[model samples]
Target: MRIPTLNHILPALAIFVSGAAFAGDLKIDVSVPADRQGLVMAAVFDKADGFPRGTPLRTATAKPVQGKATLQFTDLPKGDYAVTAFLDENSNTRLDANLFGIPTELYGFSRNARNMAGPPPFAEAAFRMEDNAQQQAFELK
Candidate 1:
């Protein structure tokens, strides 16, 4: 085999370093009531527009064990992010609300931010993901 040249090695190294510089992982821990059933869904948001309601940059799900569920997001770009989590007890792929538009199911947001009228604003829930790994916790209301 031929020895690798400077041009070949430099370009490969640059690509690897650049790709790694902007990526990170996030681990989430969700606490739910022991009586609760079904899977826990978590979503990641990258921008304030649309926020906790609009489409998410990524989503993850896991079943709770011992009243806690753990989920992880890998290879996310290093940037500001917000998270929303819900316990989908009915497995309907949606949060259930009562006739008054008040949520009947358990749900929460990053930083545990809450608003009396509705979901918290993106700014209230946003967190910086600057390191290679980060963690967030949520307790469903």
Candidate 2:
């Protein structure tokens, strides 16, 4: 008898499966510019809904260095997730905005998907993560 690795099973079962998904923290390390540095609040959303609200959620914040920061998400349910973060120089948890709700600070989303006119759609931000554990590194633009 042989035991199959998760890599083989995951695809066979589909990209996602009910009652089976990775749980726990997914560590992310980000390398960013020194000119824009501050506390980075990462919003980890399962979908567009329940965002900036409700209790079922995942979030992480990093104390920025001049050039880099490491973020660790705790107890994140394995599934589709989008990570959006901003350089909060003002120590505010919310995005700093201009007159028209346009952001004044450096911001980013997963996959680095940017919209021509505004924010990317939720589908664009979505990334499928496996259960158990994972680690990733992203270089900010």
Candidate 3:
């Protein structure tokens, strides 16, 4: 309701708008051992990280070589997040496993947290995006 007050709010608005400019574009380097097929897909989460459940904020697919891949999440909000991926050897869109419960597809998570019985919690995989541009390297377990 104050006209001159707009001047005082301009700086805050600039910072807010600047943050949106780099919302996504979260660059992530993934290093994982692909299955025999050499196909891999990385899922990156923004606010909610998939662990113990593997819920992804966003997912990107790539063909890995030498057990390594570079994945990126465009338009990701600057916040706490995590990432994961699987070999997708069968390309079934889901990680397959044998009767023994061993993953048929090579799979991994951020922070390389491996649970013997189940997936890790989001809190365990969570990391902060301190800058407008963020980068991280996640190794597949």
TM-scores of all models?
0.89, 0.72, 0.73
49-73: candidate 3 lDDT, tens digit per residue? 2343556667788877776777777
Clashes of 3: 6
Q: Write the per-residue lDDT of candidate 1 for residues 14-127, one digit (tens) a residue.
A: 989888777578999999999989899999999999888899999999999999999999988889999999999999999999999999889999889899899999999999
Candidate 2 whole-model C-alpha lDDT, 0 to 1: 0.72
lDDT of 1 at 26: 96
As for TM-score, the candidate ahead, 2 or 3, is: 3
Task: Name the Cα RMSD for model 1.
Answer: 2.3
Candidates sorted by TM-score, descending order?
Answer: 1, 3, 2
Q: In candidate 2, residue 125 scores what lDDT?
A: 69
**Candidate 3 worst ten-residue window by lDDT:** 45-54
Best by lDDT: 1
| Best of the two (1, 2) by lDDT | 1
Clashes of 1: 0
lDDT of 3 at 128: 78
Q: How much is the lDDT of residue 80 in candidate 2?
A: 81
